[model samples]
Target: MPNAIPTTELYLIAMAIIFCVPYLIWRLGRTDYFAPLVVVQIVTGILLGPGVLGAIFPDYYQFVFTKDVIQSLNGLAWWAVMLFVWLAGIELDLGEAWKQRRESAVTAGMALGMPLVFGSLAALALIQFPGWIGEKAQSWQFVLGIGMAAAVTALPILVLLMEKMDILRTPLGQRILRYASLDDIAIWAVLAVVVMDWARLERQAIFIAAFVPACFLFRRFMTRLPERDRWYIALIWLAVVSFGADWCGLHYMVGAFLAGVVMDHHWFDRDKLDTLRHNVLLVMMPVFFLSTGLRTSWEVGGAVVFLAAGFLLAMQILGKQAGVHLAGRLLGWKRGEASVIGWLLQTKALIEIIFATVLLDKGIITSATFTALLLMALASTMLTVPIVTPKLQRMRELISRDA
Candidate 1:
């Protein structure tokens, strides 16, 4: 036993696999056109996870991903995800959404609503079968959790995709951002409802009651600090708020998002903030992807899981397109414009995975459910650029449309 490799070495080995595998696939396979590096990392995480690697080579999987190594990785993944969610929160631009309230509200509402309905129906079907609902989850919780997962739009991923297509700064990109930003807020709001625990009602009440005044003071304090100090203080605030939320059973991620929402983006240099986000993704988020992959399971049967994913993917794509196309008819969008926007908005990469992780952590969804959702997210994201590029080509003017 004493001659065994140290846990530290094993952990480093796991880290090396997590980073190297995805980069090699993404670079050599040249999947950036269809699956960006981030998407490749996510898929790599799944392939490296227990269901694939562990099933194929049980001893090797266990040797590298020892309990200790996984624990260490989870610790890092927790902070990595919290920081990523925090950045997403800060990037929300409600002010611009307000300027185009009518159009934004209609589009965001329908876009979110249709998917919620379709996904909830899918969840209902899932729960009718065995192995989908979690033990601790109420019927309502499972339904709503899956529903919101389908409805979510990954704003940060959308930004990256749009930038790659040279539309991030264009008027069309700005409009899509506004719609997605609004939906982002709604996604968390619905999540708070899903995670609501009557047993912890008093604790959640206290957290909310305290959080408001604390946010006010935190904002005031942040305004007084110089840029250098503000960065340090913000991290401290994220930890404190996240702890409070988790302590009250609302989940630390809910706290992380709220921690970012109250702070003005102007507090930090935009370039510096962007760099931090990139660096976090570069250095830490791969661990999160791997950690997420580790959670994937086929206990319900692999075929069943894939079937569920396929059904959910159809619901997601159909729901999103139907909703946006309806909005286009109402608002007089040009021909094929809704197709471009609908496809763009349907890009769910990191955020949906994060949402599914929270559900699994809270026992609202089984690992089978999580695996299906993960597959659905991966498919949806990979389909975005390939499908949208041609649509954009056919309707170039839509790219320049401001309203």
Candidate 2:
């Protein structure tokens, strides 16, 4: 016992391995086409977690991922996700969505509604089997939570993907962003409904009542502060809002998003905000992914987890494509437009994971269900570039040929 590595040393060693292994795999394997570095990191996390590597190497897993080390990692993961989610909220450009409200509403609604319906049906199937429903969830909660998870557009990741594809500055990409922005607001609002605690209704109501005035005053106050001072104040505000939401049983992540959503993006420099988001992902989000992987379970068996993942992924892709195609027809979109739009909307990486994390924390979904959704998210994201790139290329060739 005296010869054992100290907790601090082990924690540092674990962090080193967490970053190094995934970087090496991503670099050496050259999986940027199907599995990006972030996806590789998430898979590595699952492998390092109790289900995979821990199953094979019990002593090493126990030693490195000790209760203390995990606690340390979790604290890092918590703040990392909060910062990421907060940035996501601030990035939501509803003003643009409003300018294109007619098209945005129709596309966003069908895109969200169809997948939600499909995912809910899948949820219904899962609930009939044991180990799928959470201990505290009612039937409605579990169904709606899973449905919304399917409907998530992962606006941040979509932005990243569009940037890589060189379409981010194009008119089509801007249009896609408008539709996604509307869905982003709807996603979190529905989540608020799904996670609502009737027992704490009085407290939640009070929090909402207080938050409106506080938000207004906070915005006014922030506008009066110098830029440097504003950043510091924002962190303080993030903490206060997160605490209030958690206290009212709505959860801290919801509050974090709300905190950022109400604040004007112009309050900070756009370049600085972008850099901060990039740095957070580079430095801290891997920790969140690892912590998430640690929560994965196979009590219902690994095969079942994978099967459920495949089913949900299929439903998500098909349903989203169906919905977007329907919208395309209704809105008189040209051919090939819907395919590109559908694939882009299907990119659900970080947001879906965050949403599922909240659901798991609230006991609205069990670990087995969370694992399935995690796998579904990873698979869904991996498919985006490969599927969309060809569609985009073919469309370009067709246009050029016709010209």
Candidate 3:
């Protein structure tokens, strides 16, 4: 491998292309209705990665994503995702869910449970085909991992979409957030369960056993600090917890979420936190997306990957719809409400990618499987605004007529 360009210069060039190309396409192509800029960014990542662009322009791909360049990019990707996940944890409104406990529990449970069951069934079928299951994963782990990945609500991306839809402050939106938040908790817990290493079970046990008291002490310490100091302190906390979780075999992402979950969302200013998230997404997360794309493969055959992705998407969409509709019937929600909620809840992107990435990292799933899930998540997320926008408009019209 001859170095045609300085490693640092190539990295800068990669970063420039990462941000610029995606922005131009997203702005010029006007694909926001079906694919938000973030979605476009993800798609671009795949194209720039080995599966597409590298396949087409092998020499250029090698020149840009060289080993050293990739390492530098990976460091940015890791911190970016951790910060994003931590922010998501901080945004969790469990207290609000507790207030709406009955409604939240029923809706969240069904919304999550149905897709999980459906996805696990899909996993079972895929496992029989070979090249789908991870080498290190058990039958149960692979099944549960796929199921849970399907059930994920991508709370952070949910917030972004909801805000874009102008529903973030609405009662209906708050209701949706509560359900997603509860599901988020369940998603991570299930991940922890799936990744549990019996050989290191004692270490996992010790980590959990110690984490509680540490959280309490940390919370108390955070409370005493000035708000200005909290942000800096929290990053330090994120690093520590993430390290601990990885050390215990749970993975750093889980630790990142746990670090955020225990702290008070109100501890930091909401607007500033939102700004921080947006900045990370704008600056750092593109690297994550690119890194994610670079991992995509079609070794199972492109046709098989697409077919599997289609099947999983159908299962997730139908399963989520069925579950939400069931809850609506039981709770007596108005007509059209369930459909809208179901579509919105089915939105998956950031968190789903993270979940799939973690599974890939743990050798619990093959890259082919990851690629399928990636496609599924992109389609799932892209469908959200288009599907829900019209429903929301009709909902408002109905309210107007009644008034």
Global lDDT scores for all candidate models: 0.94, 0.93, 0.93
How would you order the candidates by lDDT, starting with the best?
Answer: 1, 3, 2
Worst 10 residues of 1 by lDDT: 394-403
lDDT of each residue in 199-270, candidate 1, tens digit only: 999999999999999999999999999999999999999999999989998889999999999989999999
Residue 28 in model 1: shift from native, Å?
A: 0.6
Candidate 2: tens digits of C-alpha lDDT, residues 1-403: 5428898998998899899999999999999988888889889988888999889999889988888899999999999999999999988888888888899999999999999999999999999999999999999999999998999999988998999899999999999999888888999999999998889999999999999999989999999999999999999999999999999989899999999999888999999999999999899999999999999999999999999999999998888999999999999997899999999999998999999999999999999999999999999999999999999999889889889
Tell me how many clashing residue pairs each candidate has: 0, 0, 0
The model with the greater TM-score, 1 or 3, is 3
Point out the higher-scoring one by lDDT: 1 or 2.
Answer: 1
